[model samples]
Target: MSQNRRDPEQVVAAARKGAAEAQRQQIEIIKQFAAIDCGTGDEEGNARVVEIIDRQLKLIKGIEITHHYAEGYGIHIVARLKPEKPEGKILLSAHTDTVFHRGDTAAYPYHEDGDTAYGLGIVDCKGGILVAIHAVRIMQEADMLPNKEIVFIFNCDEETGTPNGHAVFDTEIPGAEMAFVFEPSRDEDGVLTARKGACSITVEVFGKKAHSGVNYLDGRSATVELGHMLVRLYENNDNVRGIQFNPAALYGGDYGTGIVSDHATAKVGVRVACQADIDKVKEIIARVEKETYIEGTKTEIRIDRISVPMERNEKNVQLYETVHKAGLLLGKDLPEQASGGSGDASYFSYRGVPAVDALGPYMYKIHSTDESMRLSSFEEKTALFAVVLGIL
Candidate 1:
């Protein structure tokens, strides 16, 4: 090693100091992120958030930034930092969009009280974005940036199942050795080692329409058939096995009770623990589509979106070990967990890149009005990530 190059302990010490110095700036940046109304499908709102991130990334020299736009979806930003003699590629990702819709920020503006910060979408992902930004900034400022190709992805669609973000991953993640997703850590300070697969299904039922009083027996009730199918689907939910079958919304029938309904539609959400469980869910759906409660009714099942599980495998475990070692350097023991909620991390893992998640601030009540993050965690996680980058 060159005399000018610091040892591992010295590099980590410099990163820790940088993280402490950047704490106030991180909070201000997170507030700016929280002020944006970048809901999942709000193109304009998402674009505004993208601009904020772009401006921040511009502050770091030698970064190559590109914007990828998906028709009918929002923009996904990819920033790259290439060293002269690259060791390998590292992927760090965080979503720009949140579950909060437009006008949510106006209703509940970003605010800090005591040791916590609260606002719409503050913790769900806005905080995560700040973590990634500060981590890179810390590494750059300390002159401790590794000799690797660092790829940072700020996806615009994640709350709605990453409709457009996956395309960005397909292009960028191929040669990356490992990935880190800056989602909020679990309330207990646990990082995600595994996540269940999720599927959004739309079931439509068709039936003959007729006047209830004039031809009640001739017409088949689609609503009645839908109810039976929903019951069967809900029966597949096994809490003990971590399988969730939720019939979230139902729509059917006209206002007049005298008329027999012709159409019915239902939206169902399913979560499975493993890849095999996905097949089981599909089998159940196939059986439901084939069987009918009403003799004349026909049912159609359409999967709106599907996210495969991030199973706990050796590669993922090895990545977690690296993260754990980094956490130990910071005097923290980061526990690994298997989450029921799915995330973009699963996409990279499925594509053969070792991945770990929940590397952001400690947060709770995500996607709810009470969503908030611990202010101190911003500095801690930033330091953790900077050290991880250094040691890598």
Candidate 2:
């Protein structure tokens, strides 16, 4: 009874019935949101988003709403859309924070031309939120909404790897059968099947400082040792192993010239494709700390913020079938592919939920002033999403 192998023509056609006009009207949602500056940790900008979401959700009927917040992070809004008594739970994961700084919106206002809308976070997520909002509204009007506990989890600080939002997910992400994340499609028509996980590894070296001209032989240069250690860390970046290590920041020596450095620190970004690779990378980090290039230097390694890899698995393949069938109904190719970027959705994948991402729009330039997204995919992707409720 699955449409996984069904012909494209056999797909249903519901959203396209009037998808264009509906999207044209609702497109304003993204524009209005894009104009507001909601950078990571921007209180005023995030507050503006809270106001907008609060106003819009108020228009919908019969939905349970809850607010979760982090002390310094923004807010996480969860809304359950269904009858008081629902059939099942399907979680929709998304975020409201953008990488745009304050006043960036003022310089680059939301602009649209020839089916493309350019603005900060437009393709990254504001457009994604718009599609979901319109999908719910249109489905409500057509009386096609199924009796399912469709929970919409929108959190702040996703731009910063959901640091504070983890509290929000711990409270809500459980019990969901699956999670569909809207992170912008891999391409014009590609949905994500897998994504790399990331972590930060910080290594510090402590060395004895001595006069460069007089007691140089007794002194050990931590900076020189760090340089050798960097080579070892970067050697772990093996394409075959699906792991990448990049030295992001390096600080060595303190103050002026003619002095042996006492301290050196190297901050590296580690990305892994799977848990095996994650372990391998961790081992590599440990190995580097044990071997010191400088004789007198002591090395310390600290690895933090390990994210879950959304690896392509059998469960995700089945998930792709369901979403592909929904896409078929919309008469579009819904192919699945791997992505290199990590996101908050990693948590759900980490928590044992079959999750897929890149469900937003078709756009490339993200986190920059030239950011833009295809308008047509908004209608197309939303159309497919509108049908997912019935199928799930």
Best-matching candidate per TM-score: 1
Quick one: best lDDT, which candidate? Answer: 1
What value of lDDT does candidate 1 attain over all alpha carbons? 0.85
Where does candidate 1 stray beyond 4 Å?
1-6
lDDT (C-alpha) at residue 21 in model 1: 88
Tens digit of per-residue lDDT, candidate 1, span 1-392: 22246576876797789889888988888888778887887888878888888888886788899999876657889999998888888899998888887788888888889999998777778778878877888788777777788999988888888877888899888779999999998756777879988989999999989899998999989999999889888876778887778888899897468878889999999997788888888888998788888899999987888898899999999999888988888888988888988999998998899999999988978888778999999888888888887777
Q: State how far residue 50 of model 2 sits from its true place (Å).
A: 1.7
Model 2 spans with C-alpha error above 4 angstroms: 1-14
Error of 1 at 170 (Å): 0.9
Give the RMSD in angstroms, all C-alphas superposed, for model 2: 2.9
Write candidate 2's Cα lDDT for 275-318 as tens digits: 98888887888888898787889998888778777888877778
Clashing pairs in 1: none
* Sequence-dependent TM-score of model 1: 0.96
Clashes of 2: 0
Per-candidate RMSD, Å: 1.9, 2.9
